[model samples]
Target: MSNFSNVSRRRFVKLAAASSGAVLLKGCLGNPPDTTATTAATVGSAALPAANVGTGETPEVTTIKLGFIPIVESAPLVIAKEKGFFDRYGMTGVEVSKQANWASARDNVVIGSAGGGIDGGQWQMPMPHLITEGIITNGNKVPMYVLAQLNTQGNGIAISGMNRQKGMGLKINDPEYVKGFERNQGRKFKAAHTFPNVNQDFWIRYWFASSGVDPDSDIDLLAVPPAETVQGMRTGTMDAFSTGDPWPYRIVADDIGFMSILTHQMWKFHPEEYLALRADWVDQNPKATKALLKAVMEAQQWCDDPANRQELVQICSGRNYFNVPSEVLTAPYEGKYALGDGKPEVNDFKAGPLYWKDDIGSVSYPYKSHDLWFLTETMRWNFHNGAIQDFDMARNLIDRVNREDLWLEAAKEAGFAAADIPTSTSRGIETFFDGVTFDPENPEAYLASLKIKRA
Candidate 1:
C-alpha cells in the first residue's frame, strides 16, 4: 500500500479556510510565505471544490508523487501545485519533489511506481520515444505518455566573454566567421549542452552544420548540468552553451557571456518540454489523469497571461524553486532579452518563450508531428540507430496506445472549445532558420536531405 493518504473533503475545506486567514495575517505582518515554499501542508487545500460527476464517472485516485527540475519552463507544474489546482481536481495528497537533473527526473519516474519515488512530472520532448525505444532505460521500455507541452521558445545559446572578445557575434551561420575564430584561436571551439540528444544538442548541431562547420570535427561538445553552464563559461572551460532560461539570462546579467541567439529564432513556435505521466498509472486512474491535465492546462493559461508575468516570476524565483534573482526570470517572461554585448533590448514575439496566444494558437498542445521531429533528430544523430525507422513505428513509440485523447478530453473539461483542439495531430510543415522544412509524412526524406547526419 502507498504510504500517502488522501485528505477527506471536509477536512480539506477546513484547512483551506484556515490557510486563507493565515495568508491574510502574514500579508498584514509584512512577512508573507515565499510562493515557492508552498507545499501540500502550506497550500491547505485545493482552490475550488471537486467537480461533480454523474453515474458512471470514474473516481479519482487522489494520491500522486510528481517530480520537477529547477527551471522556469517547469512553471506550469509549480503553479498547479502552488495555486491548489491539483487539490481542486480532487488530488489532495500530491507531493512535488525536486530532482537534481534531467537524468534523475527520468530515472525517478521509471522506478517510481514500483519503488515509491515519482509517478510523473515534466520531461523532455523526446524522452518518451527514447524510453519506449529502450535506449535510456537499460533495455527496459517504460510505457510513458506526454499529456501536455509545458512551455516553448524560452531557450537561448550564449558565447563566453573570451569568445566575445575574439569578435564572435550572434550570427553563427557564417563559415568565414567561425573559421576566423578557429584560425585565430588555433583550437577547435568547445561547446556545452545540458543533454545528449535533445533540443540543445540538435540546435547546436544544426547551427554548426548550417554554418559549414562539422559539429563532430570543428567543435568539441560537452555535457554540463544546466546550473553549471555559466560557471563553465566563466572558467574558460567552455566557449558557448545551449540551454533554457533563465540561466542564459543569468549569464548575461553577470556580464560573463552574451546571448548569441534564441532557440525560437531557430524554429518558431517550436515544442520544448512536456508534462509526462506513466501509461499504466494513467490507464488505471483515468479520472486522476484527467484531473491532473485540467489543473496543468489551467496553470498554463494563467502563466501565459501578461498581467500575471511579474507574479509568476516571483513565484519561480523563490528559494525553494530556481533560487535565482527575480530580474533574470522577468526578462524572458516579458519578452525583453539582453544581448549581453552592450546592445539595446530586443523585443519580439519569438522571444516570448512561454507563449500561449489567446484563441489563435496554444503552446501547451502535444502535437505528434513535434514528437516525430525529435525522433528524426534522435535517429539523425544515431542516438537510437535502427530502432525506429518507419513513421508508424516512431508514432507508436511516442503515442503508445494513443494517449493524446486524454489531452483532448481534458481540454474540453477545462472549458476549451472544439476549435481550441487542433484538427490534426500533425502541425504540418515546420521550417527552420536554415530554410530546412520538416514534413511529418516524409521523415526519411527529411533525414536524407540533411547534409550532416550520423545515420
Candidate 2:
C-alpha cells in the first residue's frame, strides 16, 4: 500500500501472468513441491525422509506448511527437515516452503496452508505483532503466535561500488558527506530493504539516525527484491541495501558492492528473525506446536555445531533451497567475510549466524523485551501510521502474541538442561555499537534520548 510496495520480482511475475491469462509455471514463484500425503504410501515419498521416531505424545495433525525466504536465517528449518529432526519429534509431515520474498511470505501466511498458502515460519522483527493486528495484511486480522526466534546476526548493510571513497564503513564519521548526495549526484541517496518497517528497515534506519542522517527525510528508502537491489547497485542507481546473507556476501563476491557494516557489529547478537504460526492453528494443535518447536530447537543446535556446518551449507544450497553454489555460503558460514572497500575482514565464529545461543544469552528464546524493542523502533519511525500508539499498547500486543511459555515447555520436554531454559521473559538492557543503550523498562527514556526520531 505504501510506496515501498514490499513486492518482489516473483510477485510481479505472478501479477503479470494473472493479468495476461498466461499459465503460471513451476519455479516462477519459487514455491517448493507439495509434501502432503493422504496415505502412508505417498508419505514415504516426501521431499525429505522422515525418521518417525517415537515421541510418546502424538500430534493432533502431522502436516504443516511453513514459508521461508532463501536466506541463512531459514537454515534451521531446512536443517530440521533434511536432518530428520522434525520426524524425530513426531512431526513427520512438515513442509518448509520456499517463499518468493518477504512480501510473498507475508501474504501466504495470511491465507494459510488450507488456503493454499502457508501456516507460518520465519519472519522479520515485529512481523508477528503486525500481522496479529492486521496492520500489514490489508485489514485481514490474522492472529499469530511468536513461537521462537529463528536466528540472530547473519545480516549486513551493503554499499554499491560507486560509494567506495565515501568512507562508509562500520561508522560514518561525516553525516554531511552522505547528506550531500543530492547536491552533487543529482538525486537523493537511494537505499532498499527486502521489506519496509521491519528488521532490515530498522537496521538501516538505526545506522542512518545514529550517524545524524534522518532516514525518512534525508534519503529515498524503499522495499525491493534482493535481486533488483543488486541490479540497482550494479547500475549505480541504488546507493545501499540492507538484507541478510548470503545476499550481502554475494554482493561482495560478485564484485558489485562492499559491506559497510554487519548487524552483528551494529548490535552483537541482536534479534533477527523468528518462527511463528497462525494462532488458530497453534491453539487447535498444541502438541504439534511443541513438536515443531522441539524439532527447530534441535536443528538450531545442529546448525551451531561446527561439524555440521559444511553439510548445513550443502543442504541449504540444493535446488529446493537457496540454489547457490556451496562456495557462496562457505565464507559466511565460517564467520569469514571479505568486507571489501578497505574495511577489515571479520573472521570470528560468533560473528556469523548464531541460532541457539550467543555471548550474553540464548538466541532461540523470543524474549518479550526484544519484541518491545522492535515495536518501540517502529514507533520511533511512526511506522504503520500509528498502528502502535504507545508503550502500553505495544506491551499489550506483545503479551498476547509472544509464546515463550511454549518454548520453555518444549525445551523441557526435549531434555534440554535446566540451565538452558530461561527463567525470565526479559533479556534486560540492549546496547548498540553507537554507545546508545535501550532499557526495556524505561523505553520512554530511550526514546527521549534519541536525537532524530518521528516519535
Candidate 3:
C-alpha cells in the first residue's frame, strides 16, 4: 500500500467551487494571457453519465504509487485526487507520494514503490531511448509508457541575472559564441538542470546549442535537483540552469536567476514532464489503467481552467505535496518572473493548458518528433552509446511509453466521443509553437539539420 492519502471528490469539488480565481480560468487562458488567465473552463458535458463515472468491477492494483515533485506541472495528479477523479475512475485505492527528487521518482517506478517508487516519472529524462527501446534490464522489465504531457511551461532555462543581462543565447545565437561562452568567461559558466534526461537537461542543451555552445564542451553543468536550483543560482555555483516552475520563480522571487529560455522556445507545446506507467501494469489491469488515465485527464482539464489555477497553486503548496510556498508555485503559472536582481517578465501564450479545445489543452499532450530529439541528445550527452541501434526497437519503445491509444481511450471514457481523439496510429508532422513542424517518421533528416554533433 502507498503511504499517501486519497483526496475525496466532494472535498475536491468544494475546494474548486470555493475559488473565484478558478472561475476565471477558461476563456481567459485561451487568449495569450495578458494578465493571469481569467475564466473557469466550461465543463463541456454536464450530461456525463455517472454510470461511467464509477469504475466498473475490474481488477485493480488496489494501491497505486505515483511519483512527482512540487512543480506546477504535476498539478493534475494533485487535482485529480482533490477533485475525486481518482475514485470516479476506479482508482479509489490510489495514493500520491512526493519523492525527494527526480531520481527518487524514477526509482519509485523501477522498484515498484512498495518500499520505494513503483511507477512514474521521478525527475529523470526520457532515458533517451529507454521507453522506446524498452531497456529495463535492472528490474522487472515492464515496457514503460507515459500518457499525457503534463507541463509545456514548467521546465525552462534560467541564467544568473548577470548572465541574463548578457543575452547569452539570444544574442549569441551564433554557433561560435556558444562554443566560446565558457572560454569567453574568465571562469567556467556553470549551468543547472533538474535530473538526467527530462526537460532540464534537454532545455539546457537545446538552449546551449542554439547559442552554439556544445553543452558537452562549452560549460560545466551541474545536475542539481529542482529544489537546489535557486540556492545554486544565489551562490554563484551556477550561472544558469534549466528547470521547471517554482525554482525559476523562486530564484526570481529571491532575485537570482531569471528565466532565459523555456521549452516553448525549443518547440511550442513541447512535452516536458509526463504521466507515465509501466507497460506491464496496463497489460495486467487494462480497466484500472484506463480509469487512472481518465481520472487524471479530467483533473488536467479542471486545472487548465485559469480559474482553478490559484487554488491549485495553494493545494500544490501544501505541506503534503510540493510543500513549497504558494508564492513559488504560483509565480511561473502566472508567467511572471522575479529575477533576484529585480527584473520581472510576464510570459504569455496563445495556447496554454486546456480544459477542452478543438480538444487539446493549452498544455495538451501530443507525441511529436521533438520528443524524439532527446534520443540524439542522449548520445550527445553520453547517456546512450552511439548505437545507430534498431529504429524498430526505437519505435516500439516510444510506442510503449507514449501509450497514445490508452490516452485516447481515457479521453473517450471521460465522455469525449471516439472521434474526439485520434484513433489512427499513423504518425505525421507535429506542429510546434514556432510553426515549425516535425514528422516522427522522418527523424534522421531532423537530426542532420542541426549542425551539432553527437556527444
Candidate 4:
C-alpha cells in the first residue's frame, strides 16, 4: 500500500480544522513571532486538508512532497499552501520543502522523498527537457511533466557598482559596454547565474551574444545561488549576474548594483518557471494530480490579482519562505521598480504569472515549441549531444502526453469556457530581443541563425 492509503478522511479533517485555526491565529500574530519547531509543526498541520473535497473519489496518494527554491517566482506553490488550496483539492499532506539550488531540486525529483528526495515542485522552464534528455539524472531519464507555467517577466540582469560607475549602463550588445567592462575591470567581466544550461544562462548569453560579446570568450560566467548574488557583487567576486527576483530588486534597494535589463524586455511574455512532477506519480494519481493542478491554478490567479499583492508580499517574506523584505517582493508585482542607477522609476508591465489566458493562446499551457527552444539551447551549449538534425526525433524526447491535456482539464474544472481553450498547442512564432523570430515548426533555422553557439 502507498503511504497515503493509511490516512482516514475523518481523522485528516479534524486535524486540518485545528491546524487551519492555528494558521489564522498565527497570521493574526504578525507571522508568528516564534520560529520554534512547534510553531512550524502547527503551520504544517494547517497546510493539510480538512475534508476530501473530490467527487467521492479518493486520491491515489493523499500526500505530496513539493520542492521549491526561495524566490519570488515560486510564489504559486507558496501561495497555494498558505491559502489552503492544496487541502481544498483533497491533497491534505502536502509539504513544500526549500531546496538549496536548481540542481538539488532536480535531484530531489529524480530520487523522490521516499528514497530521500522530492516528488515535484517549482523548476526552471528547461528542467523537464534536461531531465527527459537524461542530462541531470545520470543517464537515467526521469519522465517529468510540466503542469503549468508559474510566471513570466519577473527575471532581470544586474551589473555591479564598479561597472555601473564606468558608464556601463543598460546598453545591450554594445562595443562600448564591453570596452567599458574591460577598461573598468582590466579583465573579462565575471558574471554569475543560478545554474548552467537554465533560463538564467540562456538570457544572459542571449543578451551578451546579441551585443556581439561572445559569452564563451568575452566574459567569465560563474554559478552562484540567487541568495548570494548581491553579496558576490559587493565583495567584487562578480561584475554582473542574471536571475529572478527579489535579488534583482534587492540589488537596487541595497544600492550595490543597477538593473541592466529584465527578461521581459528581451522577450515579452516569455515563459520563466514551471510546476513540474514526476510522470509516473502523475499517471498513478490521476485524480490527485488534477486536484493539485486545480489548486495551483487557483493560487496563480490569486497571486496575479492587484488587490492581493501586498498580502502576497507579506506572506512570501516570512522566514519560512523567501526571507526578504516586503518592499523587495512588492516592486516586481506592483510594476514600480527602481533602476538603481539614479534613474527615474519605470512602471513596466510587471506582467505577473499568466495562469490562464485567452488573449495569449493559453499562456499557462506548455507549448511543445517552448520545450523545443529549450532543447535547442541545451544542444547549443553542448549540454546534450542528441541528433538535432532530425526535428521530429528531437521533439519526441519531450513528454507530450501530460503537457497541455492536463492543464486543459484543470482549466475546464476551474470554470474556463471552451473559447478560452487554445485551438492549437503551439504558441506559433516567438520573437526575441534581437529581432530574431523562432518558428516552432522551423527550430533548426532558428538554431542556425545564432552566431554564438557551441552546437
The per-model lDDT (C-alpha) reads 0.70, 0.83, 0.56, 0.70
> Once superposed on the true structure, which residue ranges of model 3 sit more than 4 Å away at CA?
1-51, 54-61, 121-125, 128-142, 169-186, 338-344, 347-371, 379-382, 387-390, 417-420, 423-437
Question: Over 4 Å off in model 1, which ranges?
Answer: 1-59, 165-170, 173-187, 342-344, 358-360
Candidate 2 regions with alpha-carbon error over 4 angstroms: 1-55
**Local error of candidate 1 at 321, Å?**
1.4
What is the lDDT for 381 in model 4?
A: 68
Give per-residue CA lDDT, model 1, range 225-283, as digits (tens): 86577787898767888888888777887888887778877777788888888788887
Per model, state how many residue pairs clash.
Answer: 1, 0, 46, 4
Highest lDDT against the true fold, candidate: 2
**Rank order (by TM-score, best first):** 2, 1, 4, 3
TM-score on alpha carbons, each prediction = 0.83, 0.88, 0.79, 0.83
lDDT: worst 10-residue window of model 4: 23-32
Q: Please, what are the lDDT tens digits per residue for candidate 3 over residues 120-217?
A: 64334464236435342343344676666665555566777565545443324345544555577666677777665556777676666655577767
Candidate 3, poorest ten consecutive residues by summed lDDT? 22-31
Clashing pairs in 2: none
Residue pairs of candidate 1 with colliding backbone atoms: 153-353
Please estimate how well model 1 matches the true structure, expressed as its whole-model Cα lDDT.
Answer: 0.70
lDDT of 2 by residue, 371-452 (tens): 9899999999999998899988888888788887778667655555444565556788899999999988788889999999
